[model samples]
Target chain A: MSLFTQSISPETLSVATLARIESQGGIDPFASPSHPPRVSAPSFRLPARAISAITLLALIALWWLAAQYKIVSPVFLPGPEAVFRKFITVARDGFVDATLFQHLLISLGRVFAALAATLLIGVPVGLLIGLSTVGRGVFDPLLEFLRPLPPLAYLPLVVIWFGIGEPSKVLVIGLAMLAPIALSTAAGVRAVNEERIRAARALGASRLRTVLHVTIPSALPQIFTGLRIALGAGWSTLVAAELVAATRGLGFMIQSAAQFLVTDVVLVGIFTIALVAFALEWAIRTLDRRLVPWSGRD
Target chain B: MSLLELDHVSVRYQNAVRDAVADASLRLSSGDFLVLTGRSGCGKTTLLNVAAGFVSPSSGMARVDGQPIAAPGADRAVVFQSDALFPWASVRENVAFALRMKGVPRRERDRRADALLARVKLSGFGDKPVWELSGGMRQRVGLARALAAEPRFLLMDEPLGALDALTRERMQTLLLDIWAESGTGILMVTHGIEEALLLGTEVIVMTPNPDTGQQGRITRRIPVSFGRRYRAGEPVRAIRADPAFAAARAELADAIFEGELQ
Candidate 1:
């Protein structure tokens, strides 16, 4: 009785009703009237992880083949296995007079020293140039002149002044790292929206308060970008500085190994540098994600 | 005393050959809504900027509450055409920035920002990044940011010009609602004549700079008062739709665009 009251049989329905029912079966509302079939948006495709793994395997195979066939001398191009053996030897017997931990500590210490000094000087100068018309007028030209000079160019002069010591090394690397950071910071500062500045002023904020609350917070992402660039510069500059006149550190080991033509040792040092650079880069990316959580995903 | 007054104010940029605005004077009372309408480059922006103390007059002077205006101050707040929210900040952070500058504590500043955002119909958008917002939503955030300061005067320069037609209409009604609640003095600049007619309590039609000639010398100036203060003399839409607006508009257009004011 309930079924009879609530429903009509398909056979009993009229042609118009049947057509409406048929339309409900498969017709998409969004389909264009002129087109027989609906147009669907193309879905995005991501590169598969399996593809990346295969690429890695292919690269390793090529390296092994080159080494095994003597396409390059073993002295110059050690097989992956040989390189791994050297790595295990270093891990056990150390790279030089110092252990692996000692060399790492020295490198990390140098980087930290240079970074600290750069931050101390770069941020204030950047903010000054960014915020003040007078400061920009005075300092911008000076900065532009200094920014392009490579850090290696300063080593000879720094050595003459500070004489083959850690101080000279630190000064060279720190100054090299300073330019990009300060410039990027200034750019960030200048790019702060004028509306925010005006609004801050309208709220009875003193000049100092405006700079502190509005300007600095707005310019932070750019400042972080500068720091990342500066870190890279410092790392590369540290290696170059160490290469010139150093008794310790990975760069020194590479330089010493190159002199003796111990390509295996040199290769080991090169691999270590690459590994450390990768680690530093990964740390910076993680820092960026954490600090600027709203960094333009859209 | 008039709440704000412009005394023979004229502005000329240093490189420009002619004054952008010449010998413009007006008196505005508190709670008054003033709309400025003219041909492009007839100096509507220059006049509003001078009034807000963003730009100085090349000649004459401007006064607020009988005091001579000199620089941008807390008394006047501006809503810009671009809706320039800081892209790096979340909507809440952007709204709270002005308050933070004024030394408001963190708790209070956040509270006030939330309230202001609510006023602009953007209550839950506080934590959203600016880049994630649509154009209309960004402009609403801008309006809320400006209103957060609670200034004595509000200066808007084509604040809704970037929005689509439907959004623009909605924004206009929203602005009217906010105005009714706040009662702050407003000076708005727009190229849309109908918008001026709909929004202004007092409408001032500006003439383009004139050259010496019979037609050029006869620049029309009319004051439109509407609604409760209509004075039983003129119909608002009829006055706006009248042939006089067209003639004035054309004459100003010729003066500005053709440089043949006469």
Candidate 2:
């Protein structure tokens, strides 16, 4: 039977069932509490290293088949071996007076700095708006107006304000990042259980203390959700910002290579972006796991 | 002197045409446990909120210890029917939340919280999150949280009404124990007539709203000492064997369901 249905009051029976499901005395169906239990007795599960080799072989076969048939032009879609050679050439020769490492580092630094700036401004503003009616009243109209305007839409203004320097790139990224974090924090704050707030007040908590202890803590799960969304936006905005003005970042490299019809190099840049985004998400998920272990049961 | 007094208290919501609670007056003195038994929406919870100072009465005085009650404070703790334990917090942290709000040191808070949990018979489950507990266990945590504050007045709104028959009975007994130990005057709201009789020093039978003015009152006080020592299983046997217990229970049930006797 489906766990949730509109017919049954989930609040009544499901809550009780969920409570029983989360109980500590019983082991999770999937995870064993004691001594790293196996989900299914391992049937010689291949390591990623082994799987990578198999994947490489499969790709090579597909590439060789395509090349042999000439269904696609070699110039447009290079074979796996040809791409590997290009990768080696780039690793050896470097591009635009900078190595791949330098390009990657510059992009990473820009994104990180932008994200940091977004967090510095967005979180506090979100909290202020979220916690008090006055703050929300003051800021919500402005935010609603701003939230819909694309981060790129503010490009000309930001360029005029800060110039096309690293700061401007960071500012653009931060602006893009801000909405998700601030909006999410506000949502999280609003969602904090009212009962907990009352309970805290009853315990003699001053207004400020209650916000700090009860409201923030209870809102944490939702706050992290907002952070993840903000990070994704920040990453996208960073790439867009880099493309517009930067001479040396990954986005610039891709744009420059595309102009020269160096498709292989452009592909590499795109792959690098995908890899970086994945890593950032992985790190955030790890942090979320540590911070909100209770979310795992659901 | 009255320990807590609501003099002609009235509350009307923004959208509602009539008052939710209108000119309701109640006086709860020291050592008195008042149970307000009525139908749902009979304004028992609203009255409790007015007493706790969460809801402002439109035009009446609500005073505790001769001081006017305004915003919610540690002086009047409430145990909600929903249990309302912070889902993010472990059982210990949930109980200790009030103490933490009171600026109790972490170690002291933990110690006091542990004792409170033990009082509710939730000793080993302190580290478990509120979500990890049974409905009854969560309610126990709510009870523990209210008790941890050591409030001057306790306001319980059908706190044990959400539980099963067995757990509800156990909690009623637990509540009596806590009340006796603390001597904090209680104003509980429950629908169960038997529960009101078992727990209250005075049972107030509130008539449904739109007909609210002065409604119901029963003043045959239950002797606090009668069932203090009896465990869960023993109470029914002993109480039923006593003829007076049956009579008082009948009287209370009648007062709640039927019209009050003046």
Candidate 3:
């Protein structure tokens, strides 16, 4: 009966009958549909992003509930409203001699500076390792030695060598970033399609030109992947980096607030760090889409 | 010497194995259409690679213009089975790659690239990315990119092996047209027996050893003239319709699978 209302059947399914059915306003002469066909949403589908958003909402609600009921001391886990108010206060009134924006800017500067350093040093070193057997022999062990060492593990060493200066903080962050960039670049270079190199060489590109035009361009996607990983590494290393006598940074602010038992300010600092990292990640993903749109399309 | 020659060439890899190619030889001259066909494991591609200067013969000679072919060069451009175009570039930029390497001026190279794109029947597609094109179109772009070098010989490793049958037939015609117009010698490797007969003035059936099935060598060189007939203004369909084309195709297929068991 439902099939008759819809007017799709073995008779109607034929091409010759399909035209006749289309000519008439009534899909079925015997029974008209209760309403016109509604294009309903696709069934049994939940967007992954919506799931994450819901989880975040739940966590925030749980935080609010715990704070409202006074299940934990205010010093430990403040209400979202209190943290939000503190965030506003810091954004406007400043915290521990520097405002929230100033601390964020300072940390951003360090991360960017470290990133630039990594690019300058890592790309060439990676190219050497990828292209030269001797370079692989020389640098492979050194990189492997350094790559797994936690930023905290090397903090004392950096401080001892560089004397707790701004360079020391940047250097520690750069060290954390270096291996990802260099290794990813090496992998990218090594994974370049052999046929592309041959095609370029046959087109009369010199060895140097081939590397410059073919190898580097082909590896751009992977290099960008490395940069994203480096950003995450450098961001995580920020707190450790600032522990070296830093006066103005989110890490320093968080530590200073923690010592004073200013839970709201500490929460503010942590939230800002996470928010900024999220923003930077989104920005990088957008830029990657724009620049290397051809990366995995084929 | 022919424009390109492989004389008694054999190639052995570094590790424990038989020679990948054992004692194979062939010649290609200007405007000549030569095809290498065989079953898999027969090293037909290895022979084409030697001719392209991508691989050197371990014991014998691979030469162009009587000069020992040492590395991949402009004289013998190669089209791979995989259309290995740079994704970072537009189609025009890819086609102009050879001219760019030669330090050709910007305007001149762009014009030449456009001309080559037209030759490959892909007009007005210069600004498109390689990934945006279909398989056959990408293959055509690869052909245009190679032809930009104006190579004396074109070596291909099953350039049409990836396309559907209809696209393959169209490309076969396009390849012949380019050969007739440019006078570039061609050496191609393919698994298609009819394709070899349809496109080759001369076809070499490379055979793997019956005993070991590892060492590959040339067993028969069958000369055909279908590509030449098409080049000389005969219609493609009519040429294929000829009784001789069918006879030659059967014979080529027999030669390719000769040493293998029934």
Candidate 4:
């Protein structure tokens, strides 16, 4: 199955790592006197993931019972089958001149595009706040001002300044993301082990070389965390930005459905967004595992 | 003049009421293994940091052959108490970090790093990440990395402090071996009186100055021969077994305890 359909979660990653390590016959890297010995068998632990799965089933059963009993109006809370049927129809035929896949693709495009822009702008800003007193003096207050601002709070102001266009949409999303990326980058830079920097200095590294080789690499895990947070912010602000103008995105699809009180279609859109967010988290986590493998291990 | 000297060096940190190291005089030569031992508040580490050029003396001079030390250089490489290794790099890469900073070629650096790792007896473990290694192994990597700089004086701040007792003993032997072979001037700081006596050609016990209320000052200096005895084809346990070794440890311990109580 594609990553979007995969039921990846936080708990599974650790279990998978443990299984891989045990399979290789190496003792657990973190095994200590306090830690109990590993089972050395396999990944399927009953109490571990089964509880979440059961909880999900119970919630779905409750939803079905409530729908069947007409406890809430159908316009507000549709049955699961109705939502599923709407998902199929939207995937095959078009919903508001675009299919479900098209809406999803456009939404992903906007988020990723905004993500690219934010990364380009945010990383250097973060480094500045981290590296020099002057950089911190200039940028720290700006970031403080920008952070904690709701995307909706800035929507009208962005629209007024940049005009209602693709730039404004991307701008709005990018603004929401810049603070997390920049702030996390700065924190990571500041948190780099003091001795590591001192070691670099004593080893004939020039100031610039020390930053490029030691400082940047040391700050990478934190930078990646910032990116993940920025991506999350992008997803959250996606619908708000799309609600502004001409759009063929997931946010627009959900908003369009809500206007007509198409509760089933709205549920389907919401579910798709949630699933896609999970997929994004999984993809970034895999990337983090590959790129910053030393993060938590130390 | 000594090759490295802390000539009555004293340091008072910003906003501090007293000096960390108060008018402390110490010296080490190319073949000397000098150990500074004291209570927790005593500036054994602060004194070492002065020699390493990490901290500047507030009222006294730190010098190299009377040149006056200004900044840290590869001439004096330090192995920190925490081992302060780069987690992002593999063992070989971490070992070669000094060479890499010197614009050495990748292949030559790798070759030299592997040789150094082997010197530390971590052969075939060059490709491993630092965290995968045991504490003792990581300390070895720190030593190997310091050696890669080919420093004239190898300054260590309790480099084996985090290791288990057995590992710490093994590391003490390795350090003595390195000192004899490389002839690098060694300045080390430690709390273990036995460790100081076992490894130091000259051991100094410093006490926090009661007058200054937390400033460190050297109170006693003793020249010992166990490190030299270990060098003279003597086994470590044999040197430790000697009555002289116990005597020196007792003297050092007494000084530190009295310093602590004061």
Candidate 5:
């Protein structure tokens, strides 16, 4: 039979058959009717907010029960109320010499600075490596070598080279963010659909124009994924960097609190870090939706 | 002078034992619709790529307006089998891409894009993202994008091979309409025998030559009069249903299968 005229058998056209098809993840043959259909509210999957809220409440309840019953010892795992009290105290007075907000700002500033530096330097180098064999040959070995090494492995060297100041801390975090951003960008560029490139070239686009319009845009979805990963890496590296160095960030606050047996303060620091990391991830995802809306669709 | 000429062009990839396209010659002038038809692995697409400057010929030359095509240029545009539309761009921007590359003002390019979109019967779809379009509609957008360049020669590599049969038939009619209106020379590659007869002013059947140790060469060249007859305002269904059209299609199909057997 011609592809256009082929039809489902009569046995396959029943409501039961249609339901079976739908159950099997095939299209709902009865979704659209030939005549006016019944106007009914469409059903949807469970809302993500509800699921998250339930999970969060359950975890908090478990934590409260554990502390109330002394299951794990309050000294080691503080209750949610204790953490909340600690948060209020830190917000009102201070942690160490700086206020909670000040410590957060300092950590955030370091991460953002490192991220900005990473993007500025990494994106262009990544594109160059992606576009040119020579660039790849020159940089691939070094990037590969540095990428596998843990950021903390070279912390001593970084401190010795740049001194245990802001620059050294920033350098370590920036280095941590660098590999993911550069590698992902390069992969994105390399993974640009060959057909799109051909289409652009055939449409009379110059090499530079093709790279700007087609290559970069095509690579963007993957690049954003890389950025999200890099942000996570930078955040973790910031904590590591601050753990060994000066005294103004969340990491330093958490470390000093532990030394003084201030478990509630450490809990506050952990929650703050978790919340901020979550916010950064959400922001990147929102940006991805706005900028490259077509990324994952096709 | 011909708009596109391939004089005994041969393309062979590195480390390949035989030429992908072996000493094939063809010409496309304004108002010409040349179709290449063959079975799988016949290298029809390779030949089309050679004409489009995507693939370099190992011997002989492929030229446009008597100038050897060293690299892809604005003078020739290609409609790939896959629509290849930029999924991120709206239909208007995708169609206006060539003009935008030339640094044309946004207003003028959008205007041109609208006109081209209308020509492809996608008048109100200019704002839609390419991913939203169906396969046939995407191909139409691809055609509009190719035409936006105002190329002297339009090349296609199995442009409708992905569509449903009904959509393919509609697209064939649309393609003929565009060719009739634009008067641009076309060199299209296809595997459908009936499609070749229905679309081409001249149809060439390609086949791999085992004896000659060559991969692809033209086995037959048949000048078609039916497309001209159809273009002269005859009812499309009537023309397609005619005995002459059926005979020609069958003859071409037989020749292709026979070449395959050889």
Candidate 6:
């Protein structure tokens, strides 16, 4: 008898082979590699966290030394302490007659509003494109045209169309965020396994039920990936949007501070944007782990 | 009365010059186990798909209970070779999916799913994710899911094609037991000659159409009674080891080979 047939039960052999394949970083036996893996129960990685913190502190120290030693002019590169002081000042006295929180909130509000709109409109449109040839014919060319154009390239047109107001700013950011969400959702829908769809149909699922229950759930991981990408794109576009026209927002605050050569305030704005963006990504990643736990494992 | 029937069916895909399935007719009544055996591209699957209502016949008709098959419905369930259980759902939930789709209440669906799982020898495995199951277990789950729909006719396309020899034997026995207990008509397509003789109440041998040079036409229909012996109280292993069984299997194999040569 073959070794596979001789020693152990076939079930055990198959399970062992699957585990071996998984250990080798082969395709997951349970989930597709494209989907997210189930999250393991939370465990503290204090050593890794310490190392990350140390690296950040070391970079900040190097920046401080370079500024203090005048290796780069303080006017161009403010020290971390200077930025910290500016943060306090901005919190107390405000910038451009708006408090720091107000600026932060306004920028946040714009990006989030755009994100919400993208999810609402882009997801359905993307699903349509992914599921049906007619939907693809209708929207593919339009999205293709929009996707490659940089947000700034269309900023002038947006301002002209919507005027230099909240609508214009929101519109630009929304447009910037829309493509990834739609594209990813479409990709996700298309990526749904043919067998799964067939199984659903065999189980007496209507076309609508198959799309809703099978297609939507299968496409969720890719959609989450798109959401992450769109959030980043939207944040970057917020700066450009504010630069064009905005009375409030961190983007406006930084641009206005740059005119006065207030390098400290500019640095603070940049750091705050980075921090918020990082937090947003982390939150989404955590949610993805919880929501689509069946993604990348076998 | 036939549970499912295909009358002189031919399936020709658009833009294809010849039919995939040509002038093939089949009937499956309750408690009947019909196995269609042929080599690849013989259009056995296309015929199955036609009967399942996934594909409409280009020229002829497929019906269930005298009603024309327009599309896929709950009356006919398919078990695929891939064991396409939903990875996102737990074992119970996967089995319960058909019930849920049919608007069965949650409590009843769970009860039916659990009972089906037990019938398939997967009791207490309800909460386990499908991906974690072995190939045989997955196929069992797939079978349970198919049964959950309470289908009148079970159509399988190479359902045990992926399993190892031992697992395949085990699955064959399991299939027999399920068939005896459920009494649902089964129409399965496979390439294995021995599998056909061993499991089938009637074996239909398909070959390329001699006249049209198309993909498939039924060449022979052989009635088998050995499987009923197992139902009549003989052990499967003894039945398999019997000389009569071996003779039947060899005859079927030679017949299929002769068709291939022709």
- For B114-149, candidate 3 gives per-residue lDDT tens digits of 999998989999999889999999999999999999
The digit string of per-residue lDDT tens for model 1 on B1-262 reads 1387889887878787777787888776767788777666667878888887778988888999888888777677778888767766789987886676567899999999999999989989998988789888888888788788777788888888888978886786677668767888888887766566556776676656445211111133445443223333454456557776666455444433344433
Regions more than 4 Å wrong, model 4: A1-49, A69-71, B211-213, B259-262
Docking class of 3: medium
Q: Looking at model 5, how many pairs of residues clash?
A: 0
Check candidate 5 and list the clashing pairs: none
Residue B39 local lDDT, model 2:
63
The top-ranked prediction according to DockQ is 5
Across residues A106-195, which tens digit of lDDT does each residue of candidate 4 receive?
888888889999999899999999999999999989887877677888899999998988888888888878887888788778988888
lDDT of 6 by residue, A158-257 (tens): 8888889888888888997777778878988988888778788989999999998899988887787777777877887778889886889999999999
**For each candidate, what is the lDDT?**
0.72, 0.75, 0.86, 0.85, 0.85, 0.85
**Residue-by-residue lDDT tens digits, candidate 3, A1-298:** 0111111112322322233234333356446566556699756868888898999999999999999999998889999999999999999999989899999999999999999999999988888889899989988888888877888998999899889999999999999888877877887799889999998998899899999999998878767767777787788888889986889999999988988999999999998988888888778768977998886674
TM-score-wise, the better of 1 and 4 is 4
- The superposed Cα distance between candidate 2 and the true structure at residue B235, in angstroms, equals 3.1
For all predicted structures, in order, the TM-scores are 0.78, 0.82, 0.91, 0.88, 0.88, 0.86
Pitting candidate 3 against candidate 4, the one with the higher TM-score is 3
DockQ, all models? 0.29, 0.41, 0.63, 0.57, 0.65, 0.49
Better of 1 and 2 by lDDT: 2
> Compared with the true structure, what per-residue lDDT tens digits does model 2 show for residues A75-189?
6676666766766666667667766677888888887887788778877888989888999998888777776667768888988988988888888777766766677678778
Clashes of each: 0, 0, 0, 0, 0, 4
DockQ ranking, best first: 5, 3, 4, 6, 2, 1
lDDT (tens digit, per residue) of candidate 1 on A65-158: 9999999988888898988888777767886687555676787788779989988888888898998898788777877666677767778988
Please, what's the RMSD in Å of model 1? 15.2
Tens-digit per-residue lDDT, A1-298, candidate 5:
0011011122212332233234346775576687356578876767888898899899999999999999998999999998999899998899899889999999999999999999998898889889999989987887877776677799999988988889888888888777777777887899898988988998889889999999999888767766777788788776688967678999989999999999999999988988888888778768978898886566
- Cα lDDT of model 2 by residue, B141-259, tens digit: 89888888888888888898788999888887888777777778889989887777777777776665334533222323334323433433456557656776678777766655554
Assess the local accuracy of residue A192 in candidate 6 as a C-alpha lDDT between 0 and 100: 88
Query: iRMSD (Å) of candidate 5?
Result: 0.9
Instruction: Give the worst 10-residue stretch by lDDT in candidate 5 chain A.
Output: A1-10
- Candidate 3 similarity to native, TM-score: 0.91
